[model samples]
Target: MKLSRPLVLLAVGAVVALALLAGIAYIFKLPPFREKGEIKAGEVCSSLGSSSNAVDALTKVLPEESSYSFDENIDLRTDVTDTNFESSCFVAGGGKQLLVAKARLMEDESATSWTQWVKGTASNEVSIQSLTPFTAGDTAVSSSRFAAVFVPCTSAGKAPGGQYNLSVSTELKQEGNTNDAAARDELIKLAKNAASYAHVKAKCDMAPNLGGTS
Candidate 1:
């Protein structure tokens, strides 16, 4: 059968259009977005160590008259097992004692970071802070002292496609008894403890999720 040139061209055009449509459909049907990993509850506390030692260390550095209180628990959760936790403590006789901590985890091995501020305290409050992305031994501590407005997240990572974990801790002090060096030391020690605790919790929760196999 001899087909006219214009008719053959038209037929060729239709076939090309159909093929393009099929390709588009296949791309969309393949799930362009990967499913977010799942994070199970109760994973946050699986390997949390005792905070008592840290608290006791802080007590040694604080003034004899100063009183302290600590609270530790999971605060937020996502469907993918990414979690956040907070550990706070308050000191009396120096305004309101406040400590805050937070963390996040992902199923991917990629790095990530997040920052949060201390709440329920004075707008202008003294803060002591520390953070660890990998190990507690590999930490960065601040030298000079000053009032902080917001805590910042510098670096972060994620796992493959499973759950991830994170943690944050903070200690806040109000201006009082400037001559009491011991009080300041105690506050700083407490803040360090909070940070350490948060780091440990994050590692424990996200350990199983590493490599996304879990």
Candidate 2:
């Protein structure tokens, strides 16, 4: 039996409408398409979140007698992230050092999920030496004189999701004789201290092995 012309036209219209709806749904599912909140960026020398928190989380790990400078010498270049919070520090004395800390308030991220993000970020580097797992978070140390540690945390001691990444780079002065081994150890110390933040401890416990290059 031959279908009427009007009936065939009606069928085609229905198919077109369904396809358009599917496209819209897919767009909304992407990260960029979702609602975005304001991202705050500042260059304060001390304090983490507010004025009362006297301790400066970013520079707490540096060695004693090392003077802290705000955004004057360090350059993150292409590694900069557009997250909710970010801080950078440059320390001089024992050696010229650069440290960067970044945080994202993800509402739905697991240890496994954030681990992948960190690994993916490091995969493209020239050489990745180790990716060790620890109680607080996973640490990735590269022979390139750089280290990154990622710790899962909460936004404000309230659960949902929060994750942070701390990366440090060490550069010896032209006439200095410090070795990379000493600098690498210092970087690890910084990472451990950063993970001790109240917000990080609130969410991070004896985290399970999330498998990385280590």
Candidate 3:
């Protein structure tokens, strides 16, 4: 039987709409479209929507097209946040890659270890060759493509000297570009921003006199 003109037109329109919908779905699956997201941990980082600059800087490690996500768990005691953190709120432009992580400064050993490391590297005392945007905080440090910002905070537990377990820190370590001041500066921005997110999370208020994060 011959179909009416209106029926044929309607069929054609339906086919077109289906095709459009399919195209949209396919685009979203591609990395550039699909991988453009960060799992926000809320508070300061809530505003950390996917876009450019920091994320672009961070994704420099990815040779191919890239995407990113942010996470919050950090432990300074074991240095897991810096050395082993699978992800970060940090974004960098290192030749290879970079990461941001959080940790607690609960003891003198860790404090000395972390802070001294930054001071030495930032001052050029050490030679892995990192530069600085160098945002100052309660105590920040630098090393071979490594930077960490420490925010003062106290956890519930007490320390050996009757001190409270304190500090929320972020480490932005790049696999390369240790000597590029501009790149280091970007990493500093990324690190500080990540530290700020942690500062809010930690509820750090112990040293407001020392100029806490904004």
Using lDDT as the measure, which candidate wins?
3
lDDT tens digits by residue: candidate 1, 141-194:
221122111122223333334433332333333333334454444434444444
**Which candidate should be chosen as best, given TM-score against the real structure?**
3
- What TM-score goes with each of the models? 0.37, 0.37, 0.44
* Tens digit of per-residue lDDT, candidate 2, span 1-214: 9889999999999999988877786676433233322112344322123312212322333333323343432222121132233333333333444344333223334556755565554323432345444443444333323444554433333332343333222221121223555545444444344334323323333341223211
CA lDDT of each prediction against the hidden true structure: 0.35, 0.38, 0.43
**Ranking 1 against 2 by lDDT, winner:** 2
Scored by lDDT, model 2 comes in at: 0.38
Looking at model 3, residue 135 earns an lDDT score of 43
Q: Candidate 3: where are CA atoms >4 Å away?
A: 1-64, 69-100, 108-113, 116-135, 155-179, 208-214
| Candidates ranked, most accurate by TM-score first | 3, 2, 1
Candidate 3: minimum summed lDDT over ten consecutive residues — where? 78-87
Off by over 4 Å in 1: 1-52, 63-67, 70-73, 76-80, 91-95, 98-139, 143-167, 175-192, 199-214
Give a tens-digit lDDT track for model 3, residues 12-101.
Answer: 999999888778867766533444334223322331222343455454322232333443334323221221111234433213333544
1 against 3, candidate with superior lDDT: 3
lDDT of 3 at 96: 32
